[model samples]
Target chain A: MTAGVPVEPGTVRIAVDLLGGDGAPAVVVDGALRAFGADPDLHLLLVGPPEAADELLGVVHPADRERISVRPVQRGVAMTDDPRRLSRADTTVRAAVAAVVDRTADAVVSAGATGATVTAAVLGFGRWPDVRRPALIATMPALAGPVVLLDVGGSFEARPGTLARHAVLGAAYATVVHGVAHPRVGLLSVGTEAGKGDRARRAADPVLTLAPLPPGAHYVGLVEGYDITSGDRADVIVTDGFTGNILLKGIEGAYAMAGGPPASGGAPRAAALLGVAGTVVVCHGAARDDDLASGIALAAHLYRRGATAAISGLLADHARDGHLTGPGTAADGPGRTDHGADERTEETP
Target chain B: MTAGVPVEPGTVRIAVDLLGGDGAPAVVVDGALRAFGADPDLHLLLVGPPEAADELLGVVHPADRERISVRPVQRGVAMTDDPRRLSRADTTVRAAVAAVVDRTADAVVSAGATGATVTAAVLGFGRWPDVRRPALIATMPALAGPVVLLDVGGSFEARPGTLARHAVLGAAYATVVHGVAHPRVGLLSVGTEAGKGDRARRAADPVLTLAPLPPGAHYVGLVEGYDITSGDRADVIVTDGFTGNILLKGIEGAYAMAGGPPASGGAPRAAALLGVAGTVVVCHGAARDDDLASGIALAAHLYRRGATAAISGLLADHARDGHLTGPGTAADGPGRTDHGADERTEETP
Candidate 1:
């Protein structure tokens, strides 16, 4: 080792919600151990009941045990509870988010209800000024490379303004996280034509086309559902939360039906909550051991890559121009009050 | 041998629009040849340009030529044109529907635009008395069996009433087509819980539960995206065409990604247009030769099995009782008007 050489910094401390998934302490413990074992520099701030952390500690080698720490809290958010329940104080998901806010942990990872995790992240870390709604972005390892699909389950409604903002978020994510040079963004529609989707898409098209993107990103008009896996047309695909959630599950089911996923891996069971100040990744409530491990890896990846800070910096410039907010982007779009996947356990896949 | 005998009528004549696809007469002609060669009892009333039918005639066996006839008119409905274009005289799709109306053909099939085929079927044969917005149904092969998914691209708006009607249509189709004695119908939503989807789904859930279904059919509440392909929860899954179209394509892409489709089949490129009195099947505009042949086969199967008449009869009884129209179901929901996947393409498969 050379004395003057700059040391590599790969230490990533992820706050893991021990009471997050369907199997709760059991699945979370297994996943954390797996993630910790895979990366030598990885550290975990186990956030849940002391008993849950003890279970994770029971398995780690004495030498590696130093990398794991505990932030004990008893309460866990039930899948049926409203996402706003995270504000009730000391809930595992909320505590996990708080760990990141207080710098006790570098990032947050959870398999608790998506809505609860999103709410907690927004409340604890705050949202970016230019992005009204925080989006859940999942990267699919497409044939062309990694394709970033956003709003997997953050919010249900798709306003012209929200969609325009998502374009910026996705474009920046593709550049900072996936490292695509000039990210091509696209709005998910039924067809690739100019006028081929529903009302929300039709209205959002012109708005997304008008809005300016960050860095070297540009809009690629409309792309179809096929483009998500193929990656022939767009590197970043923007869609309302409802369609995105369904598409994610549908792709996962197809992979399962086809016996296994492609070599690059299947649709992600975890998605990163973009626009929040701190890095946060939400896993499916029914996520398996590997899904939880992958979620932890994703959170660690975000922290190591400075994705949240960098994407926020990208959007800040757009906000300065006053062109960030989309036209007709108010608190909510017309007619649609608040709609999305019910805040509950996803049992299908 | 008996001195006198009566031959059972096994002939099922189909009117096919040769100019319906992106590949047009070439793919259609090849498909017609394939179909004619496969079924000895099948008859064709080709309804495109005389030259196109002549192309088909060029390949038919001399003895089998008696089973083919031409209803030549040289117009095709361009996919980009509005669905209302079917009203223009001499359009191939319109002529095909007219052939079914006049009893010259037992059914009609087109690889043309979906909206145009639905419109032509409605105008030429009239919508069934019980149904409002005619739905398009595609049968996807699942591990359990066949799952009937409706409104693949029929219309965009998801009115509570319209959804209730589609449930009835889907239920009857499942029983008659797949022969499931008790078809379990599920409203396609984000979750399986009672309140699991957006406003449209929330409003439709209660209405579907309260609505009386056909014989041996029952509602299974809300089902997630996985149920469409897995068929573990329900036999019939209902959703707005915008969502259905996107999900269908997304599933197709996933299959393509996972090497190929399962042994059963890939996503159906052709879907049956339900709620119309006459039998009609619409294929993708970019349909290959096999897809075009399948469209013709689907149309013939519906006619031979009396699926259109039987399903209509099943709905008629409910229509007589005034249970077919859902509560708060009008033309459009409340605010939205006349917006859907432009009645042009059923393409993008």
Candidate 2:
């Protein structure tokens, strides 16, 4: 690595899973080069087959190549493969997670099968204390600023408790990462009115209002799809993974259909994985080179800012006061333990 | 109302809710006037408080006033009003539905509360035999052509049978209205691969595959949000009401954010309410003058083409045979009534 001037003392290292994504090695190679070229104090741990790493090594200059370390692994989790296969020992994704667990890298970045990355992260980096479901947070560049949308493609959750926890995670992220002052948080639904959605949204509405928010954040009631684009109503928009995932993809598709995104910005293809005890950014499965570079940049930014520790610390403090506590327990929702439809009996009637 | 030509033999009469939407009376009046101006032989039964219709009557030429009839209902259905109130005769929406049932109007158009419109339509026209849940179908301008998405905001149904019935309705509508050579129908889910979604989608997947389709349609397995905008994969995209409604709004919001829609067209705010015996178009609750006008135009087009009757006739023919003998029905599991999640217990595991 080129030892740069002492701007930030510690160099942040990111483990890039080269085998992930539809484009695989070619796009991944191009993205890694771009990310490395942009960040002077950044280092990359290439985790995949040696040949894939060599492909990147062949192109980059010898001076920058020192920053790149290769962790050789062969197998990859396919799009159609079982999500649990990320747990397999020789798989590149699992190896990449192992590198982070072993302190070889400060953060992880992948464009692999989302379920696979999520599983690997959950299994590798221990879940945050009292945080059951680790969420995938995507920040879209809106007219006003970056609008933080969470649970875009993590665990599928519908319980009021999970929603409440995700709201807290989102609020903390907005304040710590985006530096928003008194971030306004909103729950995503069809209509802005309190009772304008289906049964799950109806149950979650009052619960969100009643729950305590992180310092400098307040619940702004329900927000419609427009707020996600305008970023006028709320800084943080929270929803179930199922809805968020589809909404994110829908917006992306819309931008494509419209020829391009607005002059302000467009829907994001990369999302930061929160709730795990590490910094990770997951890119779209069909991401382009730039999207992967964005994912890499996000991972580096999170690592530099110590976002994981700060947000986790915020949650720990919030939990100690028993503020904004969910149903059953703090460790009872999407990330922490396995809960099915039966657990929602209290809110479902 | 500008009657430029003599009324045709099969002139379709549409009841226009003149006091609906945010910019009521003004926008609705303008929309009704525009729709009349556009369609030479169309007839309009204006349903609202007399003041709204009076505003329209003052502007129209004397000879064209005969083409416009007013039903002086005192109250319009407020957006915040309970949907159950739609059954009351005093409401304009209910009276509008009554016009259709009374054979005064061939169809109805409203930019009011979706729940109210659905409730009034179900009460007045009655759902088609065996149709427990009606769907809202919207045609999106896609790259390939029109991509028909259903259950935009009709009823929140997660049942497999409801989805299956929606498939039949969508296939029939695509063939009769859109006139695709061989419509390819897809079930909207998280992934194209089998077993790639939540419980509801998983349950609906096989049921949709096994269920009978209407003429000139083939099941193309699972589709994602992108398919709705791109239309490269399927002509008809199907999903639960909750998901479809949110996706439609999300796309609409994106187009608005991007300044405008693509050259082809933008997301539609107007959707056709299917499963009711009569033809009805529901615009967004926050619809502007142009949106209201577009809804009216869609209604007139549907009425002129006899699309409702043709689709209904196709379904009737299937009913007569006691089974849908369409393209994809004879390939898989047993066909059954009742589309709830309970039906999938036997098929899944």
Candidate 3:
């Protein structure tokens, strides 16, 4: 599907990858039950072995059993498995993503390894037209607002073109998913100075300045690593997947070192996969029960908000203008649409 | 100077960059005063304007005035100034570094821009035979113990050869500075799995495995960002300068978000500059007086422990064996000495 099927309000069906996490079946079942009890209108498509499905159905209220349906598949991808394993179609993460592409579920949540889930989502749902490489967005609860960090682990390479494109994706995600109407996006660098970063960041800074962002979003030069938690510098922070993943884990580790996290919350173990055609949330491979539950909740929330569809549509506007750097023949076509005027006509005007 | 002059016990003199931080001279004066008051045997060589030095001496007790001396330098490098400005002998940071190189001081501490300080130290102190690029090592107080993080902002690039050399440096620093025997060194990668990192990491991993470390130090394979705080996986974490700096700042920001750091301390605002011949410590550009004081204290600690000489002494042993990668004439000479086996003859043998 080029675009995700529009999610209906108050009835979000999420495909849960029962065998996705290190504590598979057990922790996944606990997370599913918790999410089911909290969100009355939520439904779950259990994709794993029949025994694992039976384990969850046993504890769930019989009346609520109607909300959950089992899709049995014994084969699942292990954390150490190669990404090519997703082609088998029987892996729990692949099957979970397939449910969304086939319209059997509104979104997918997996506590599996990020690489496996990202590969499955890309293979199953396909990438967005303007997104050559997908991005994973992780939000940290800063004092001012939530800091949206992108490309957490979608890909390792940090080409200048990819960093700029991810900036666009991150800006849209911040506005649509986090409700930041006029999001301030910044390129994550070692220092906030003009020429303060590795070669990729130095090259990406000028490109980000020229790249046309969606309506109500502006690029605010370079930001330091501290901005990720302070939220005083920018709302959306763009970085290479390698640096983003390391930074997230480092922040999480620091929180753990500092007795506990602040009253707001700890570092997020779940991240939303952007640039895919379907809504997907990936939890940490070693996810705890609450982390899985939070991942499920994040998926449901994104589905309910129609975030995937809205973000894709916003990017489509930029894609038509050739503002987003991607691999596509349509980018130079005469049939391309222009809605640049429509963007500024809103609040930003 | 290829080798630093050995420091005398109970008479370690430190050169303080008077015009170093965002709050120059004033905050530096406060820091120098604090450092002077705390250590009875410490001597200070103030390197800045004569006016700034006189202001400091105005407040000091008459009896202790003999311990403080002035090396007048009217010019100071600004954060935005070109790094080449360090070539000007008039700059305070360069003058401070010269003090250590010329045996006027045992160590140097600067709260200036990291790039400028690194440049000054390299120019004044010269580099060790096997170090192509200098390294900034910051030790974090993790739950288990002090976690040694290297290349905080030594350079921007991450070549395989450089990373392997940095592993050796980090391993040696942990052993000598932190008093940790049998230091388990780990390359900071996205995952602990063998093949999970950027191209540089993939290439460097194997080199690290084959790279012979000093006494009681061994490669522990790839480690994640969590290892930087938990200290469970590795005692010495090696990463590229860019990633290391960002991770350090991110952890510091996380601690701020979580209200305060644990009882031990927050992420260090000061770091020791390695690979140079003399002892040097660089504080954050935005460091407070207490942070500068801590930086001074760190410089004092390194001077007292004779860390720079010892680390270089150890690296020289590797240089003699041609185990280190660098462009140096001394590395190819037959006159290179042998002191590595001596390190282990005491206990590891």
Candidate 4:
């Protein structure tokens, strides 16, 4: 029966948590159907109750029905649940990550509570070597080009070493995934001048200036918040997750207030999870069907581009070159303690 | 000579810093001319070099020349100059503030470095009783009337007491100035949930919950950055200056990226100085001629409304009831110290 399935060379299987977003099951079912209908070679592994999977199968074209599969799981992480509960292995997001671990799917996509998703991914796929805290990178569709913003919600630490590592990750991701050559990386602050931000930013700026960037990327001096949307100064904007998350949402709100986004695009509803061993995408918790579909498409695209492996390889190369140091290293200097533990339970976008 | 000039009952006198902002003198001249031409009941007290004042004089219609007066001072504070240097009396921003102190001007407007303007304002106008830190409040013209965002650049500290104090200021400003009947004040965070932010926000959230708000104002719990532009959640959004300044500029940049702002309006270029004894508006340091003109107009409107005196009276009422507590009070709880001094030297918007 399996041999009869037509699996094309470009086929990319995605494990999606059905009970993820605020409009879960319904929106996820509709989103899965839309994603399946949009890409002929796409396959979905639905990780939720059988009823939700049936809803998608009921409406899909008869000819394309074979592309869908199901992994029944009744329990799902609640938005208010502690992230540590993901260890139970029965939650839908965890099941989805397990599919990726078992090689049944190429990647995982979930719009569930971000803390739960990040914890599940970390437990199932593991973190990259020397990466103490993972970073979530969002691409803003600026008019000039794509502006990559990092640590949107992965880790909220403001440590200089953490920011410096994320800068390297962001530069590599922009170059590897977005095809940005010699990406200009910047530290986001209140102003562009060198000592213009809070204690964390002021400390991180000099560390980033001295830290070795990925092969082609170079650190631009401090860049302001305007630079995030303008995309005039830096290709990759590195900031603490606390600031990045709020700023990303603020830009999204501004676009909504302006009737709609620009000709280029609006703030992205989907963000890529870096510093993890497998490809993963997390959508907004209040995501609509289209946003979930976009998340699925982003996961597939990243898997097809071998983005996870390529970025991990770049980090490894840097580590091997003795340039990469994890959090709390001497490179971070004094006053740079790990603030990630306390903020680990906060929800992401 | 001054008695010959027409002084209407509605006339507002504003001291304009002719050497403030990036495009100093030239853009300031154009801005002052634009402001003078637009408002028939406006009076200008130009503070800058003799040549720059003469430039504005050269362009004005001869019939309206009496409405403009010049205070010749050679030195203007450079963006790179330390804000502490504003103690020198000859600087343009200090001189502008001095005009307000001497009863020659009803308000002061400057596009100079925020730290310098804030320092000068503190020295000239003095802070309100129990107001340790001054806040810069910018009003975003949302679809639903207006949204007031505070601590744009006045103080960068994240102390719980400071945030609580700013919340009171914001609620009063929204009610008295924006005429918001009953303002819903919210603490800006990564998420709307109670425990969804970093350490500072987590500490500040509970403090705000119990802090005594002015009459006709209520705490709406926590709000995200999107609330600033959407105007869906709260009328007053409070955050530390570091976050507020960046978010405001980010919204402005988003508007620029969206071609233009909505019919309602865009991000405000001028922010009112709250917690000070006098009416003051600080324009963006990168202000263009139109932005500077808008700052002047905002100053005039605020002065005409007697917003500063009214808000101060409201605060006094609250304090008389024994509800207002300044920074470092027991109301702030433990771990809330004054982080204002360190960031005082950093340039504002």
**Candidate that scores best on DockQ:** 4
Task: Return the candidate ranking by lDDT, descending.
Answer: 4, 1, 3, 2
lDDT by residue (tens digit), candidate 2, A1-349: 0011123436889899999899997898889888888777889999998999999999888988889999998888788775445467777777888899999998898888877787788889988875677788988778888789977878666666788889999999988988897999999877786676666676678888888888889999988777888899999998877778888888989998998888777788888888888888888888788888888888888778889999988888898887844446533334321113421100000
**Tens digit per residue, CA lDDT, model 2, B1-349:** 0011123345778898886776787889888887787766778899988888988889998899899999998788776666456557778888898999889988999888788788788888988865767788989888788898987878765666677888888988888877886889999876787876666666678878877677668899988888889999999998877678788888888898898888778888788899988999888877777777678777877787788899999898866766544323332234221122221000000
Docking class of 4: medium
B-chain TM-scores per prediction? 0.91, 0.89, 0.89, 0.95
Query: For each model in turn, which proportion of the native inter-chain contacts is also found?
Result: 0.56, 0.47, 0.58, 0.66
Question: How far out, in Å, is residue B222 in model 2?
Answer: 1.3
RMSD (CA, Å), each prediction: 5.4, 5.8, 8.5, 4.4
Lowest lDDT block of 10, candidate 3 chain A: A340-349
Give me the runs in candidate 3 sitting further than 4 Å from their true place: A1-9, A328-349, B1-9, B84-86, B325-349
User: What is the clash count of model 1?
Assistant: 0
The C-alpha stretches of model 2 lying farther than 4 A from their native spots are: A1-10, A324-327, A330-349, B1-10, B321-349
Candidate 1's C-alpha runs over 4 A off are A1-9, A83-86, A326-349, B1-9, B82-86, B325-349
Q: Write the per-residue lDDT of candidate 3 for residues A61-147, one digit (tens) a residue.
A: 899899999998898777566645545677888889888888999999988777778778888999898677788888887878888
Kindly state the number of residue pairs that clash in model 4. Answer: 0
lDDT for position B235 in model 3? 90
- CAPRI rating of model 1: acceptable
Which is the winner by lDDT between candidate 2 and candidate 4? 4
TM-score of each: 0.92, 0.91, 0.90, 0.95
Best by TM-score: 4
* Candidate 4 residue pairs that clash: none
The whole-model C-alpha lDDT of candidate 4 against the native structure comes to: 0.84
